[model samples]
Target: MGRSRSRPVRLVASDIDGTLLGDDAAAARFRSTWEALAEGERPLLIYNSARSSEDILSLVDANLLPAPDYVIGGVGTMMTEGRMRTRMEAFIEELGPALDPAAIAAIIGSIEGAILQVAADQNPHKASWHLHDAEQERIHDIAARLRSAGLDVKLIYSSRRDIDILPRTGGKGSALAWICRELAVDLDEVVVAGDTGNDLEMFEMPLVRGVVVANALAELCRVVAQDRRHYLARASHADGVIEGLRHLGVVR
Candidate 1:
């Protein structure tokens, strides 16, 4: 959906869980490939995940993942950058008012099977939950209930288990777009990777190429299949990401 693929990649953003994790060896390979690139050729790296900024940083500290230039965390409601992990104030300000988790909890209190995620997963702008085995109708009903109650939010159901309620304007795609605008990077020059439904938003961005790891959830695969700009790697996790990057000519 973006311009053309002729532009050299200037940014490589990926989800942390199923897209870039799971295989230590593959993670090492990705790190080596990324580090091997000449400094001027290296793209701005970003890790976009449903995880908290601190949670993602811990992985970097442990060497499980390469450090990122920026982190789009909490399902895109929060962002932080650099070693000190400074909060992205402009992004936060653009997200408008934060949604109250308590208010959202009360609204969905009576919805059967809608269990709130742990406090660690909850954030000021994201009211997350675990709705495993719940019917799509039921999940939509919960979202409907909240909207009917006057809350302006978006419902992202991913991994067939997670339900993240974020501000209508928030999502990985929107968050990445904000970064591209701020950094003056063209959307066509940004490549994204992920493996779940929540990661769908990033893939949906117009003109942005994407990699859907082989281990990705079916919900994500079905959508990516329709877009030829996105590559579905045969390998899983980090290896899949590397495979897609090579296929897209973003890496050797």
Candidate 2:
């Protein structure tokens, strides 16, 4: 449903979980497409995921997916070059001491009871809390709680099961912007692919073109459809990602 070409892509940003490795079939296809990229033409893979950096790295080690040139972890609250750093380190270095972890923790703790209760009731294992619409209300409540505590926190929707709480000033899109600046790559040159809401901010950026794989949720599909350059693939999961990449002319 899209065109294919042999042009070299400089940078590729992809969401993990549902986008690239939701199931074995998808994972295999994603791996193959990744492997097919010519070494010289291989774009730097930016692994953006809600998973903690440790978990993300562990998965990379276990699955043998090519190590990313950069990893945006904790829903982009933390970033690592070749290896990850503590969240405290990233916050301090990037935004300065204006961000207070203790204050943030206090705010989270204040509403922790309600959030946990709702999460537990929704899923005993707390696996599907993000899929609940009520979770959005909780997020808004949490944000208000933080603001009242003099801590600015941004509630970012990243996936069905997760929402990122970041210092009001930063998020996945912010991290991507930083990477683009560091690499001196124009934002328009980057192609972002993801299957969930967390990837929403990545698409909103002015310089980036987002491709929402076909398996994305209805909410995400609506967002992707708004952009003329954004694409909706006919495939699903890894096949969808490959299709989107091929559409961008990153693959032959």
Candidate 3:
């Protein structure tokens, strides 16, 4: 295992599903690494995931990933120190009338039918409407249509099966920047690692260094190549995370 020799990491931000945990082996290894890092060193482990805070925390408790000091969930529209309900309420207040529950519901409702059609056509095994290649392209088309209708919304591709629709102004990168400012930790000192498209915002930050793990999509590979300083691991899942940590000199 690698540990930082010169500059100890102040914060370690990572995505959950594909980058850190993939199968049982990766989950075990990631849990071991996280537990080892948790005791005494107490470096903040911020789980920046596309999952909701509730879902992320449940996974954390189940797999016993390091108890996250912070969570940036819902593609970064929501952040939670511990409990999500209070922070969510505050965030909703800040959103004001622009993010009324009814408007968001309408957006979701509008897409429900198309999502169902895609699901029926592709994955009959899955009941819920999860994005796939065709669905994502359609979602983009929907966003364009919404924009033309005078609604300002952004459709973000997270995983192959997950798309988040949000106000055009918010995203994971914005959330990371906000956390960095609050912690007084220079974004240059922080590191982010992830495996899917949702991780793009965190990778693109000029102030932050990033690693795209082996499971990343082809689109992400192109983006990572554009920035030579951003590292890509050869290994997949937790092994990839370990390799990335070594690349950053966080572990050896």
Candidate 4:
């Protein structure tokens, strides 16, 4: 369903890469739009990204992006709030057990085309890799091997090259939903924005409005097209996010 104009936006959670960081002009426009909102009318801003919380914070510190009220980092395996970097313990607790990186390594090591990403890209709950010219069947086989070994994990492939293995309960959508529940914000009051395959989960969430940036990947765009709750922006990057917010009536 389309976002209702009657409901005031309470939160805006967005992916970082192509969604917010691509164009300097668009990023500036988005910042201006956000800063222009009146205090009481402003919604809680959330930066949901595949980067680690420290990485996200660095950008905020450098003023490349506006400071966020909350950050869902490490592709949802990690969550932190504000500049003080307070951990969301409840969200961590719900993630159950840390993923076994060693076991994951053993399983994926046999796959010739897979290359593990840098240490900075991995966390206790996430194992990231790069797939080089691999087929979809290879990706599926890798996932199957992990599951057969009794690991409760979810594999996310994005930009046709990156692979992230997260706990079954962790993802952008789940992290955002958990945050909304903790903050007592209705799903309808939230607008999630993204531009790639990894961001698809957040857009699939029922009752939450979605912003599919003009530069979004085809896989994501295909899904967004079928959903009435999502807005397909005319502009790219952060400019597209601003356009979508206007269309959803979150911004004037």
Candidate 5:
């Protein structure tokens, strides 16, 4: 007996950086492949990433890739849709007023392993950081302390160096889950792809299938390789995404 290929998925949600956008040729392939997907599988197309909607639109303007049906931006802090690329006001507002970024910075500032991100990189609901390699343990201790203090924020770290403080329940997985419910789409209909630590949540979601690109950080590969739901690609960047789609039977 052999490992079975994945069942065809009805929707594809993918990360942007090393997963989709790359060099000129890769971008062209991705655009053509995705357009074919729109005509063939006709699966829902979504960009699930750490970039803000504004950031993503810049890429669209540059002709790097076509606009996705849904933009899961800011590591899922916001979602936007339609030709106008408007933010889903009701969904973002649901998280309530964001805590002051300075408030969380005050806490991380004292932590030995964490360094706060720049102001431009900060989001109302997300506090970004860069962590020292040897401080993984201290990072946990600090996060626990923050939670115990009832700061009620979730810490998302990936690629070993990046960390984000988010509302306890707001994240890529949670946002994607919300999209499914709002569209009345079944969990089994969705498949996800990514290339770094931040994307772990998308693959970890019990309801979705995971596809990892070849260029993913080694740490990410080690963590996701054991999962039965994940498909590790043979190529890098957009080529890798195309490989996963084929493995999933999304395209011939």
Candidate 6:
């Protein structure tokens, strides 16, 4: 098991989709719970998701969730301070040069079963796709071919169809670590919760004790349920996050 932090909990890092905002009822419950937390006890909040900063702002504007303290977007390829355009440009600069999107599209284009996702969904460090075939074997073969070609990207398949090719250095777990370093937050004091494949990276790190929500994809549970520091909860969605917080004694 992962070692518990010696210090008291101070922050919560979470995924947006599936994990925190699965259905309407769940989303509403999470909001209420967040509001209920004592002001003095409120932990720092960070939202890490596959969404772009623009979309994340739309959610904030729509009052779907309170403004997050920081946002890790584009499947960990981007980070921004609020919705400022300059912040977005800085994130792009920090990511530096990456494999061209056109080359990635070209490769996936040749794969009959693969279809590109929306333009906004794509990022310098991530190439998003959807699989028509959805066959595990076929996906594996394609991934192997990409490896053989030395393209050096990590493929993450989730919910049977969504596939994302991320740079070797890009992923939720790594992004969390980076954020921790930037914010001077102790790894031991952070709690991260999620519900699917993109979340798998968060669970693998010893520094991040992950809460796998009840609504999580079966494939995700099959792979991570037994790992150290990963808590499997029966409560679904936002309620599950509450359950995880309680289990860790991070929130009342």
* Backbone-clash count (model 1): 2
- What are the runs in model 1 whose C-alpha is more than 4 Å off? 1-5
lDDT of 3 by residue, 202-237 (tens): 888875777788878775777787786577788888
lDDT of 1 by residue, 79-198 (tens): 999467999899999999989777788976566777888999988889888878666787788788888989999988887788899999899998999999999999989899999989
Q: Which candidate comes out best when scored by TM-score?
A: 4
lDDT by residue (1-252, candidate 5, tens digit) is 133364557678989987897656877898888776546557888888888878887787787987678898878788898367888987787666786676677788777767877776678887888885735676688788787777878888777778888886678888888888898877777899999878888888875787898899876798889987788888888888888877777765
> Per-prediction count of colliding residue pairs?
2, 2, 3, 0, 0, 0
Report the C-alpha lDDT of model 4 over 135-202, residue by residue, as the tens digit: 67878988899999998899988888888999999999989989999999999888999999899989
* Model 2 steric clash pairs: 158-198, 187-207
Highest lDDT: give the candidate number: 4
Question: Could you arrange the candidates by TM-score from highest to lowest?
Answer: 4, 1, 5, 6, 2, 3
Model 4 Cα displacement at 53 (Å)?
Answer: 0.7
- Minimum summed lDDT over a 10-residue window in model 2 is located at 120-129
Report the C-alpha lDDT of model 6 over 1-252, residue by residue, as the tens digit.
333454666778889888888777878877777878886888778788888867876787888876677788878787766534235455455555786677677677788877889988886688899985377888787788778777878787877888888877677887777878777888878888888778788777676677899989887898888776778888898889878877777666
lDDT of each: 0.88, 0.67, 0.67, 0.89, 0.79, 0.78
RMSD of 3: 5.6
Q: Model 4: runs farther than 4 Å from truth?
A: 1-6
Per lDDT, what order, best first?
4, 1, 5, 6, 3, 2
Q: Which residue pairs show backbone clashes in model 3?
A: 2-251, 2-252, 3-251
Choose 5 or 6, whichever is better by TM-score: 5
Off by over 4 Å in 5: 1-7, 38-41
Off by over 4 Å in 3: 1-8, 38-42, 82-113, 116-131, 135-140
User: What lDDT does candidate 1 reach at residue 29?
Assistant: 91
